[model samples]
Target: MRRFVYCKVVLTTSLVWVLVDVFLLLYFSECNKCDDRKDRSLLPALRAVMSRTHEGPGEMGKAVIIPKEDQEKMKELFKINQFNLMASDMIALNRSLPDVRLDGCKTKVYPDDLPNTSIVIVFHNEAWSTLLRTVHSVINRSPRHLLVEILLVDDASERGRGNFMKLRGAAASRGQVITFLDAHCECTVGWLEPLLARIKEDRKAVVCPIIDVISDETFEYMAGSDMTYGGFNWKLNFRWYPVPQREMDRRKGDRTLPVRTPTMAGGLFSIDRSYFEEIGTYDPGMDIWGGENLEMSFRIWQCGGSLEIVTCSHVGHVFRKATPYSFPGGTGQVINKNNRRLAEVWMDEFKDFFYIISPGVVRVDYGDVSARKALREALQCKPFSWYLENIYPDSQIPRRYYSLGEIRNVETNQCVDNMGRKENEKVGFFNCHGMGGNQVFSYTADKEIRTDDLCLDVSRLNGPVVMLKCHHMKGNQMFEYDAERLTLLHVNSNQCLDMPSEEDKMVPTLRDCNGSRSQQWLLRNMTLSM
Candidate 1:
């Protein structure tokens, strides 16, 4: 019997140990799986880590990551794809509007005009039809003599090298001075106009023409949606909210209202040349292109000058399907670095918003921490409140209002007898209106219920008026008689306790007491003048 008992104890101990080992193994396996998911999710962080170590390599470093052969193939494929999309979209747009004239109307120019206006177009590898149509449209509508120069900045196009040079030469010979700026690195569009426009417009204010995009095949105006042109949210995310109906109705006859935006879409815009020079043009230190729009937009807004979308002017650009070239194997990292630079300079406290939206992404700290310090020093010209209220008014969103009737039933109970009931009577009743979620409250003959005391309990009301809890006090809680409307008014505020707005007041009787937030009252701060 003793041997059997010892054997049983050993068996029980073995079973417990086996269970422990299995649980640990399963837990460790799950942990490994979780680690794998985290690694995949943290691509942006991984890229950022890689960028810090890989800076000195420059463009070559980017190319070195991918095999040279793969890079070339990718470049070729991307170019082909972009060209195909542009060609198709352009063709479709043209077919849709076959009779669309390059010049709908012509403006006569006096010899004194002397070509004061300069049109600058920046493009990478654009389609022939799209590019030609843009030039043709400008030449046809603009006064021939006032058109001083057409600067075409060729952003290092790989495919249409010969054609682009030829077009530049032709425009130059036609009495339009054409200058092509070749950049070996990435370049953004819409930087040239603000500089040129600033030069023309008193050399003080910086401005750009409203920009629109052309459909790839149809050549129809594709962009300029109220939503897309409204700039971006803090997360570097873009959204276009529909114009309110009231505002739209007001704008029916006129479309030239000055729109204040946080940032301009980097497409086609014009700036005065003199003002452009004053603000130092584009930051020469910036890599070939990319993020220049953000830099220019923020600098313009921060440094006293304002940017606006002029409704009268419109310029169309071709939208590409994808980037034709990547920086070797590290295109994603390169772009991340470029955006980081802008975020660091302009975002300040809002920089964290970007990181939260795009986690694990690494960006180059473009404006050093001191850039923010410099911005602070430079921005001493205007109050931040002025900027928020006048310059960037879109930041303030209005509170939304919903009708009380839509949200709750406001029927009154004819069955309940209240002739002798006291103000603080506690009574349970069924809601006849079947609006189950609203609050119900009541006021007594000697005392009136303050808005704060109105409890939002839905179960106590017999009818639509939600039975809410209310504090009843002598003299302060009762309503004054209104001879004209037969309505009750609170003696404290002299406000008709159950009246709606003037538009809704014309009805014979109040259907439901509208409970607007404005109607709620606080009695402690009140001064009651009998």
Candidate 2:
């Protein structure tokens, strides 16, 4: 009986081993099929890991190079956005950027209870990678508790009024402060603290960031100069000029101190929520985006507020050569209309300077500015002259001038024209157009024959009349207009401005003071503001 029980146990054990072997073979076959599917599906994720590991294109703010085979395709895609779309696509959305701040800024500390901000980003059909990158950079860099939320505004309405769109964003915000940033920008490390800290100290302070350059072609990040600030030309166009010596002295040569700028680029800034509403958020009547920056700047300064550029804050912006979006009527027409509204409401008598610089604006229908004028009056704002005198003492616009009109040569019947040239370029003479623009010249109390920010300067005996930046210093730039003789005499060289000859390349020249008609000139539409 014992032998029979042993035989049965052996047979059962053999059967159990065979079943286990069959089960193992089936499981191995299914796992091989699953492995094949995962290889195909996870290829993109694996590449992403490799890219991060190897430091991919545009990593660390470096420029991205396009392969030879992709050059033509890149060119074609560039037109769609007026930027290097192909290169932007190759960059990771959360790409790393260098810490491009001053050494002092790196160690700066902020209050733990700093005011939280609701960032307002406005865009109209921007590229996917750039837009996402902007959002990601902001999220990654800004302190979570300090950032309430980001409101992405779609200003792509048929009217496409950027001012109105921003107003909507400001209205919807729930944070203590409202920060406006452009759609194609990257926030650098510690960019938010300095801005909010300033506002927390002074609610009426509207602060801006030092905007760095992000190359539109190579997708490379570049640091902009810390020595520049925003200013406006006579035509109300925004410009960047070097920080003056007076401002540097005020800061005591500290690179980390906030810069007191006359105007802002209007793209990236932060303001207290209640203060924004109290001072009037923005001109709803303004169209699209053109003169809003200057409008806000003037209103802020005149209405008991300060505009500043915090030096410790740095943000990268993509500077495109041309805009990709279309203007409703025409680009020039829309901008002219917007400028006219701001000039009429905020510029006071100085509006004449804008009208004279851009005569075409005289004909544009700027809609009704009665409401804007009412806002200024309600705020009991200071006059434009006060702004120029107290805030922007170095303004290009002369407070006191003998003449504000055209300078025409009697013999040639041509006007002394700027010809849209820059500083140090030869001054040209064009047929009198009667309309202001390049023909306008201002003989200031300082005795400088100026056009816009340029002065008629000639140091050599018979050198080509050149346009030097009005130095306010009375040396080569000093000129005396002999109203009796109708001659313009360069005081330093004692030479008169003569009409250009054929060999002069249409550029005016300086000659010994002669009473001849070639040296005689007249000021058309001249008005005395002295």
TM-score against native, each model: 0.45, 0.89
Candidate 1 lDDT, 353-411, residue by residue in tens: 34433343443434344644465466554443444455544432111111111111123
Error of 2 at 443 (Å): 1.5
Global lDDT of each model? 0.38, 0.83
| The best candidate in terms of lDDT | 2
Error of 1 at 223 (Å): 7.9
Q: What TM-score would you give candidate 2 relative to the actual structure?
A: 0.89
lDDT tens digits, residues 1-530, model 2?
Answer: 00100000111224323322332333234343345555344345423522453278898899999999999999999998899998887887778999999999999999998999988887765675686578768877998888887776666455576777788888877789999999899999999999999998999999999999999999899988889998988888899998999999999999899999999999899999999999889988888889999999999999999999999999999999999888888899989988988888999899887788788888889999888888899999999999999888889899998888888888988888899999999888899887778889888889998887889888888877899998888999988888899988888788888888778757888888879999998876643231
What 10-residue stretch in candidate 1 is worst by lDDT? 1-10
Q: Lowest summed-lDDT stretch of 10 residues in model 2?
A: 1-10
